[model samples]
Target: MKVQEIREIIKLVDQSNINEFVYENEGTKIKLKKTETVTVIQPTASPDVVQGNAAVEVKPAAPATPKAVEAAAPAAAVSERENLHKITSPMVGTFYQSPAPDSPAYVKAGDKVTADSIVCIVEAMKLFNEIEAEVSGEIVEVLIKEGQLVEYGQPLFLVKPE
Candidate 1:
């Protein structure tokens, strides 16, 4: 079956309270099971099939370790903090660093920028938008490449406090 069909079936199974479901259609067969603590497991087949029978097993009791969860939590927190005060795109558009092809880039990494400095340009619906720096600081990073597509709220740079 198609991936979309499989995804739809999985979604349906997740919404219902069925504990186990098995279906056979022509040459394809699928089995799904849900426990009191819901966990979905993908099926696997062994190379050697004895007596033309395949054994299917589900292992769903595995829980994430505390260390793994703790590691992930810090990463999420760091990303959230880094993205603060981001100069996001006002509209979906292609971003540019220079006013024209032959001109120099408006701003570079480590450059001290202010609220009035035009940091980049965003071309949206055939109009070029002069994206300005909304805060004053030394640029720590540039998040987008020149001529890349930028969406609304996409970060353009990271600024270190001056």
Candidate 2:
């Protein structure tokens, strides 16, 4: 399915009681399961999924299903997360942690970074786009791995401001 359709499915699933949704057609399979967060898992075999061709006929459980009520995060954890600086993707592309396959990653957890430091690369349309760290801090978390397809504005790293 197209990225937009997948996004829509994600929204629909998040707003409803559906914890898992699967769609299979034309040798393509799409599965979305809600974890601690809502994420869209890519179809494994679909070469090109057209919009309105997914043939998704979902009958979600009632909106007020007991399992749909997620537990809220603790106040301390939420406060800590709020204080961190997030390095987000500027565009949709594949995330690359290192310059080349054999090279070490630019930064990892506990690494200190400056505003101009090259943190990673995102390859889009055969062009490798070097992503920079816009804030100076110690890398507290690397939210994405190499070669993962990331969406625009998705958090890549969480930095503890220095």
Top candidate when judged by TM-score against the true structure:
2
Q: Score each candidate by Cα lDDT.
A: 0.69, 0.77
Can you tell me which runs of candidate 1 are displaced by over 4 Å? 1-84
Look at candidate 2 and tell me the lDDT of residue 158.
98
Residue by residue across 1-162, what tens digits does model 2's lDDT show? 565675676677767766656777778666665543433444445343346755444433334433324437776777788899999876568999999999999999999999999999987667788999999999999999879988656799999988
Task: Show how many residue pairs clash in every candidate, following the order shown.
Answer: 0, 0
- Cα lDDT tens digits, model 1, 1-162, are 654565566567657765545556668766555434444454464243233355433233444355445465587766655555677776556899999999999988878998889999998556777988988888877889988987545678877755
RMSD versus native structure for model 2: 8.7
